[model samples]
Target: MSAARPRVLYVTDLAYPARGRRYGDEDVFLTSRLREHFDLALCHPLDATALMDAYDAVVIRNSGPVLGYQKEYDAFRARALGSGARVYNPLSGKADMAGKQYLLDLSAAGFPVIPTVDRAEHLHQLPAAERYVVKPKAGADSLGLRILPADGLAKLAGLADGTVLIQPCVDFAYEVSFYFVDDDFQYALYAPDPERRWELRPYAATAADLEFARHFIDWNGLDHGIQRVDACRAPDGELLLVELEDLNPYLSLDALPEEARDAFVTALTASLSRFVHAAQGTQEARETLIPA
Candidate 1:
């Protein structure tokens, strides 16, 4: 059973009823492959904080939106970070790992992202459009996402400024997602029809597309973890950032060719191995400094 292998506590909800996506099936396939290299154990997200201490690292996979269990997720994050518990994504993400705040930040920084604003005063900065998208800062998987007319800003006065994000509802050609593992480009997929966001097909990313995706990956500065850079083809034939999913981004492995899926699994195994070993080394170094 390879007792020498590093053990991983894979956190995922096998039965999560995700709309338009089969979270369970993807995790089931990923876990089956991941088990080949790591001594793996599966547990639901709620139980992760309790079970994680015994494993080399905890991998947060398709656990569904954090909004469903915000309190529990907060506790888990606090405990993991407080104890230096090795999390695959490492709790160091500046994008969705934290929240959608990066979207606003990136927009203001002139990154090729859909223009976003949180306050009514910033309305001048966004392009005039018939509708706007209002989503919670902590939202995921389109949860709490709503489209409203341009005048809907008045309805949000009761909520705190940073609690919601406002962006012009764009008329884009299609959406594409670039998947990465530890800063390495794995594959790209696109939804041919915007209506079916999850009906994905393999996409051949051009060099410019890859360059656009890598910019956010490099900006994120994470040494390890999976990230999905989602963008839309604007009417101007340019890709604009939609979301930087650095925390538990779905890989859409079912949509990939067998060889691509195998390659991703291999890359993930190596990343996890390196993450665990580096964490172990750090622990050992700290122990060495203790006065015995």
Candidate 2:
């Protein structure tokens, strides 16, 4: 941390044309709010590595899909890890940050996720459905996603190589997402209409809903940063995990009430403060213990 306040390098892609969402607007709002607590600078994802070293921590917001610049992202990740730079959402995430492998792992472990299988042989593992969803393991923003008929399994034999993920197409009623900052629940929003995923409305989360979301957050084990747990209301009324978005999960702030949005910003500000201070403390301790 700086002697006065933490310096945050906020990574975002202001011009990325996200479907039905204003990536620039939300980030503009968030950084404006965060500026109250930190010395902040905004940068595009492609420029993150070159600029990251000057800041105490890097906050990756709506940076858009890594598929657009995988090599640059890989380089940023390598440099951040090697230099011990504090990255919000920490680079240790096991979910979407790492890849779609977590969905397969969670499904196999019977974690209430949509049953997923990666290979032709594993097709029998998923629940029977007329159609299935197949997507690349490393893809994001629904890129490379496909809905295929059951008979199309032959074409997916390459899935055995672990480059892709397949799940039974869930006939869900609606989708809801729970937002959290450092393992604490912040707010939730749901899309009442299944077709309009980005048309969200504020959701009154129940105890059961919080319980469902908390399980994955606890499993993720991130001591700091924001996370979003996306789940769908299955036909039987159970909430099955759709995606655990730990990397730059877009918070539909526009759908939230004023009070709720303010509260989320407060929560994030405090979380970042704690995260930066902790990293600073560790560094100070190391310096103290070093032989002078």
Residue-wise lDDT of candidate 1 within 35-143, one digit each (tens)? 8888999999999999988998999999888889999999999999898888989899999989998999999999999999888677778898888888998899888
Q: Per-residue lDDT for 152-242 in model 2, tens only?
A: 8777666656788888899999999999999899999999999999999999999999999999999999889899999999999999999
After superposition, the stretches of candidate 2 with alpha carbons farther than 4 Å from their true spots are 157-161
Candidate 2 has a TM-score of 0.97
Q: Residue-pair clashes per candidate, as listed? A: 0, 0
Whole-model lDDT, model 2: 0.92
Error of 2 at 208 (Å): 1.2
lDDT of each: 0.90, 0.92
What TM-score does prediction 1 earn?
Answer: 0.95
Error of 2 at 211 (Å): 1.0
